[model samples]
Target: MAKMRACRACHYLTTENMCPNCKSTNLSTSYTGIVVVLPGRKKGEDPRKGSYVASRLNIEKPGKYALKVR
Candidate 1:
């Protein structure tokens, strides 16, 4: 299995030490839950828009993301 790392900045999950989305060095090995965003039908709008997951998680980009970091 591949190792997982959570980004402190954006909660993005990746195997790399550095977060690909935010380029933040703050990474955590302990995290829970995962959320994925799909492309929105309208321009300049995200599919996750108005979703509690997006607002509570502070997610702006559409991709695989972690819910929490510990």
Candidate 2:
């Protein structure tokens, strides 16, 4: 298993040393909860169009995100 880390800038969860989305090295190992966004086009299923979850969490990409950061 890979150790997950949260991006300090975007709170994105990943196991790599740098965030693939933001390409930032600022990551935290201590975080809680996870949010996964499924990609599709529906009435309210599009994250790129700015869903409530994506807006509230400041997430632009559809992937695993950290709900809480410490």
Candidate 3:
């Protein structure tokens, strides 16, 4: 499997060279911690509105994310 890389701009985890979340090309292999934001219960609902982690991290989408990237 391809090793996942974390986006420096948004901290999102992806295998692709570009971050699908923010389209930032700056990615890092040196990262610690992982957070998976699940989708909201209702359709078209924002997860950040209900998820504490998502809200604290300012994440708007549901996906795997790195807690810290270097």
- Local distance difference test scores for all models: 0.81, 0.84, 0.95
Candidate 2, run of 10 with poorest lDDT: 37-46
lDDT of 1 by residue, 1-70 (tens): 7988889888998899799998998999989988886546676675457567776776777778888788
- Model 3 agreement with the true structure over 1-70: per-residue lDDT tens digits: 9999999999999999999999999999999999999989997688899999999999999999999898
Question: Could you estimate the TM-score for every candidate?
Answer: 0.78, 0.82, 0.95
The true-versus-predicted C-alpha distance at residue 6 of model 1, in Å, is 0.5
List, residue by residue over 4-70, the lDDT tens digit for candidate 2.
9999888988999999989999999999999887664664455856577877886767889999988
TM-score sort, best first? 3, 2, 1
lDDT of 1: 0.81
lDDT of 2: 0.84
Candidate 3 Cα outliers beyond 4 Å, as residue runs:
none
